[model samples]
Target: MKYKSFAVAIWGVVILLVILVPLPTVLMDILFILNITISLLVLLNAIYAKDALSMSSFPTLLLFTTLYRLALNVAATRLIIGQGDAGKVVESFGEFVGGNNIVVGAIIFLVIMLVQFLVITKGAERVSEVAARFTLDAMPGKQMAVDADLNAGLINEAQAKERRKNIQREADFYGAMDGASKFVKNDAIFGFITVILNIIGGFIMGMMQNSGASWNDILEKYTKLTIGNGLAVQIPALLISVATGIIVTRAASDEELSEEIISQLFTGPKTMFVAAGACFLLTFIIGRFFMIIVAAFLVFLGIRMQDSEQEKIKQDEKEMEERTVEEIRKPENVVTLLHVDPIELEFGYGLIPLADVNQGGDLLDRVVMIRRQLALELGMIVPVIRLRDNIQLNPNQYVIKIKGVEVAEGELLLDHFLAMNPGTAEEEIEGIPTTEPAFGLPALWITESQRDRAEMLGYTVVDPPSVISTHMTEVIKRHAHELLSRQDVQTLLDNVKSSYPAIVEELVPKQLSLGEVQKVLCNLLREGVSIRDMVTILETLADYAPVTRDTDMLTEYVRQALGRAITKTFITPDNSDVITLDPQVEQLILDSVQKTEAGSYIALEPSVSNKIMQNLLKLVEKVAQLGKQPIVLASPVVRLYFKRLTEQTIPGLVVLSYNELDPSVKVRSIGMVTCS
Candidate 1:
């Protein structure tokens, strides 16, 4: 680094010498002062440690002293020079003999030295940037390793130390190769052009000068113009020379020919005046008439290039899209419902009414009506309920087997169902068994109203006695006896313990429906036996449920269900009106609900209404905190209560009847809101 710095300093000194020597006759006094100041600073820093010198005081004093002396010396030099007259020589001799020019000469020397210092500083900065780039490029595989370590979160102190050592070793190894490559790729052409341009320009200028006339003289004679004399001539010449030098340097360094033209145009006004003045202006105007011809040629070239590139890109993209489509369309990628088993039932009632059938209207609306009816009957949200195929019962009575149940009942019946051929229980009556055959017992007795309801909904019912057979009757009796005795429950438990593994294997491969599994569990639970044993059995079975491939869809569905469950369990009536939830949670729910499947609606159970209200209140609070008002538009019942609460306090809350508000107005009225 030090050697490099010294080299830069040497170049800086050389540049200073070049600038100062040519203009010394006019600028020597000032230049001399600059040189002296730099010399003094160097002397001071060398003698005393850099820190010992007070940089602020010493530099300020040196600048002022240098400037004062330079001004005095330049004035003296100008007076002595006396516009290049004989008196100027006389004055200069007088000043030298009298010792009047010593201080001025010293100041001139210092100023030149200061300029050299500035040159050195700028050169050093350029070198530093180049060195940093070289260092970065030389470290082999550093970027890849850094990226890996960062991603894996394994970048500890020891790892970092090892990485640094590795980087340093690689840097040393590759640095030579990198430098050689860069020199071959960039420096060869650049260096060759630079040397060639320098030689050409130098030869041209030298020849022009050696021809008994300077380049400027030739230019003036040819152009029939003189750019004044003395400093005016010198300043323009200096600027032109500097600009030409830069262009030549760039050309020699392999800059484009177009760049050389631009450099020449900008370097001097003379070039522009000669080449692009009135004549060129007239040519430009004429060229506009031929623009259509030029445009046609350019457009054709552009289209050809664009078409080639675009076609290549299109081909690549098409291949990629095809591959992706193939992967997504694979049969294994489809999400199938786990299982679906149909449950058959018998009805003695008449055929269902046409009005009850889901036809000529939206499926959701019909589902809503069905749900409402079920809710009215059950006094709660029925988790699962669906219509099944009709059959005739032995009793000639409307009968239904609750084949598919979602929640567990017990183990004995579950095992029997799994067995696939479960026989019924029987019992003998002591005095009534005298060759008189009995009828099969019905699971449920249908009332006339129930029968009418069933028939209205497109169902057929069987009467009680017509279909009963003696063998079936005996089986029914035996089953009833076993059920009452709880012996069947024990048998089911034993059966489950023995056959659960086999049942699970069969179910898993068959992809049994959730309904079928639920029914088996419900029967076992209802049998009043082996509830714990049945849960264990079903738990084993549940492992066989179809594994979903759409993680995002499954996750979102589970999240929504969990959110609803949380709101129901944690949100209660007491805090429904007062409790508040975080706005973030509410927003999450809102966004999730919006993105839910088109036909699905997130139904908030009545039990969870208060919690949702609390969340809305929280949103209102947040809005208020942000210096905004919350206007709630709700059903009449809600509006009335909210209005009553806010009436006694500040009128910060506004409650509007939902029916009376415009849809757009309603949306703007609240920070957040919930609707049924």
Candidate 2:
């Protein structure tokens, strides 16, 4: 761990030194050899790797190794150009390895380039792309199968969940490999560039220095050395490319590639006998004594492979048994259960297609839009929703949950449209009678054929997804208060600190706790006033928090700060809102109120509470008839208590404090809540 932390810094320094300064011949020679050795080690590991994900760092490793090779090329080029020789390694390559012939060395280089660039690199890239596409495309179905097994009792909940997680990991692994393959392609291209620079630059230096006997002498010496240099680099590169090609194109096998090939190619003695006969015939026809020798070797290898495989199986079984016994000895209470997802949507088998992206389902996309919308409208960063299928549900039913607790649920007809009755219209549409889950509005679930007819009859037509989305929206909005934690408050403050740091620093801890601010925001959300304008809300808290630490009173002041935003959203185009709150009824409620540190509530007589409830419910009906949101404007002192009272009877009613209204917005008189 300590070494890895400093590895990048050390490499960075090495790269700078290699590029900026010339190195001694002996040191340069050692580093070059080290480079080749490391490349061989990486290549061998890639070949033996059983899974692509095991080589997940291949792309990053490719970049560093490629950089190191480039640096080595630069260092070696300087050494050879400055003097007649580079190092012992380069001298040996030019004399012994190249056979002192440029063409022989050049042909070796060309063959390595051709094989790595055209054969291995291109094939690996194509395999990566196709594998990525197929893996991603299969995820939805794979997840659905896991859900099926869980619901059918074929597997327990834990087993099915583990399978789903593995499927996701596999998809991610292939996707990463698709991008990593590009590094190998670029590395091959760069190898060609490196060779040209060395040869061209070396010749110019040799001629310019007058350190050679003649032009021919200079040409021959440099050509041998350059090709030898190219040979040293290209061999390892070719090996690595072949290893990469092997890793990306193979299927997952229980054994290593060599083991699997040996096991399958000559699994039984019958195949070995056939091979021995063929070799025996070759020896009789001509001087092919080696063929008979090879046949005997093949027969021996076949018998040995079976014995080795049997021993490996027994060893594996013994190890697995020991591990199982060790695991079983642990107490059952020590095993941990899974953590809960903050938001989850579970649908039944019939509704699986609605969440499957491959089948043209846009529900998941719509979920992205939902989070964006809430952030815009409510100033809240909603958590990611986990959408999965559940066989435990009825075919058409779905449930929405918060922290693993089912909060809201609804049913959808996959092939039908929900046509809701627009209250102003008297006409009735024929279909399956039902009520909208979000608001309990009178609605009918009609088939696709009746959609146009229903619209023609003045009904508001909506698709199944839209119906569910609306319910999801409302359920989330209604529960937004509970969702706001102290952490959520700190997040809001931190966001403000980015744009308005001084304001948050001065207000929090100095004036009130995070719980206090969270309470203020929750109070506003409970009344349907959007907290989207967080800047204003926080500023308002900062202004009055020092004077009074009461969250309820502070929430009222924050509401006033957000008056413009609230009125713009709730008021009509003419900037007008209709509300009812008779002063006499308000006074009577205030008179019955008792104050506490948290807030105040109306504790009226049973008869008085009854009178207030009846009139409020009547006013709600009246406002509904006028097609306006029902609101009751009151003093801040009584606003919170008034809301508590109405929620039990007329839950959709919007109760606002008078100061919450913007001065510029107009108000119209509606039915006043008088004690009738």
TM-score of each: 0.20, 0.55
What number of clashing residue pairs does each candidate have, in the order they appear?
Answer: 55, 0
Candidate 2 local Cα displacement, residue 557, angstroms:
0.7
Query: What is the C-alpha local distance difference test score of each model?
Result: 0.36, 0.79
Give candidate 2's whole-model lDDT.
0.79
Could you give me the TM-score of model 2 versus the true structure?
A: 0.55
Error of 2 at 272 (Å): 19
Error of 2 at 171 (Å): 41
Candidate 2 lDDT tens digits, 162-278:
898778878877787788778778777877876676677777888898754688778777877776666666666666667667777767776787888876887776678778788
Best by lDDT: 2
lDDT of 2 at 532: 71
Candidate 1 lDDT over 223-326, as tens digits, reads 11110111111222222222222221221223344555655554443433443344445556787645544444445544654566688789999999998899
Task: List the candidate 1 regions with Cα displacement exceeding 4 Å.
Answer: 1-5, 19-289, 321-676
Top TM-score model: 2
For model 1, give the 10-residue run with minimal summed lDDT.
413-422
